[model samples]
Target: MASRSTLLKLTFVVAMVLAVVVLPPPADAAISCSQVLGYLRPCIGYVTGSVPGKVPPAVCCTGIKSLNSAAKVTPDRQAVCRCLKQLANGFGSGPVNRAGAVPGKCGVNIPFKISLSTDCSKVR
Candidate 1:
């Protein structure tokens, strides 16, 4: 009985040690890739849209390059594209609007604006 009790205690100690070694760090312990991505999302919209004026928001540019490094097609890229299209559409183009005007016909269809432009400059 004494030997069995000693063995059980030893096994419990080993299990605790293994648990401590194997467990992941706590959520607050460090910054993770997902957290970085989350921070970048809003910046994407601002940069792509040329917010507050013609000059792009500096924060937006910083996050986008970091996001691009991680993935070929990032969530940030999509957000920025959508924002630019929406901004362009706000300008409202005309029928046969050849002079770098956004297609007013799209109205709320931000996706359609991108299809019309080779680059955003053409739409703006």
Candidate 2:
């Protein structure tokens, strides 16, 4: 049987694909890609396995919680969704599963999955 961490990792990978399918947003995006990336960068080490642990670091959780709080409305949420989708596109499966596990590990509940077929249009 798979370890708990492995199971969680697989679940997140599927969610990441939900984000993967986010279409390009309008020119007047509520959130910028830069902003989304900034909030997420701190978690990269944990998600990518550079950090040696199953739990995400405090800084990583803080960023995820902050991002969760920051995107208050549908437009902002969708903007974030799109940005996340863009992020997943550049990474391979290993990182995606790792990244997927971060939000849950940090105690944040994402409103939607982040997989390629997630249909960001329905994120709200």
Candidate 3:
């Protein structure tokens, strides 16, 4: 006894529900690449050896610490790793890809290596 319009509306609703349930979740649902890059910007100069310093500056360390804290989950860590790899690739053959030392010098421990060869899929 349902009217045609009522049945169409019901079908639409059901289809929407099915789509929501069937679709895979977003890859970086928890973390964003922009966020990962934003947190590491302060350390870029020090990390790339473009700036003269025996150690990373306090601001650089602070940024690294914040990045480390934000990447607590596996997905977030993987996102960070991916972002670092992307940045490294953009840097060409320059030494700007020396991000691995920043974390250690800054005393912040990241869950994954920042090297270009680091397998982000295995970050967990």
Which model scores highest in lDDT?
Answer: 2
lDDT by residue (1-124, candidate 3, tens digit) is 9999999999999999999999987766757778977887787787677887878889988988998887888988887788888888877545544567778888877777767788999998
Backbone clash numbers for all candidates listed = 0, 12, 0
Candidate 1 vs candidate 3: the lDDT winner is 3
Of candidates 3 and 1, the better by TM-score: 3
The stretch of ten residues in a row with the least summed lDDT in candidate 1 is 99-108
Off by over 4 Å in 3: 1-28, 92-97
lDDT by residue for model 2 (16-76), tens: 8877777554554487779988998898888778888979999999999999998878888
Ranking by lDDT: 2, 3, 1
Model 2 stretches with alpha carbons more than 4 Å out: 1-29
State residue 68's C-alpha deviation in candidate 1, in Å: 6.2
Q: List pairs with backbone clashes in candidate 3.
A: none
- lDDT per residue for candidate 1 within 1-118, as digits (tens), equals 5698899999999999999999986633333445454645554343344444433345544554454343333343344444444444554443213212222221212222343363
By descending TM-score, how would the candidates be arranged? Answer: 2, 3, 1
Instruction: Give lDDT: candidate 2, residue 87.
Output: 84
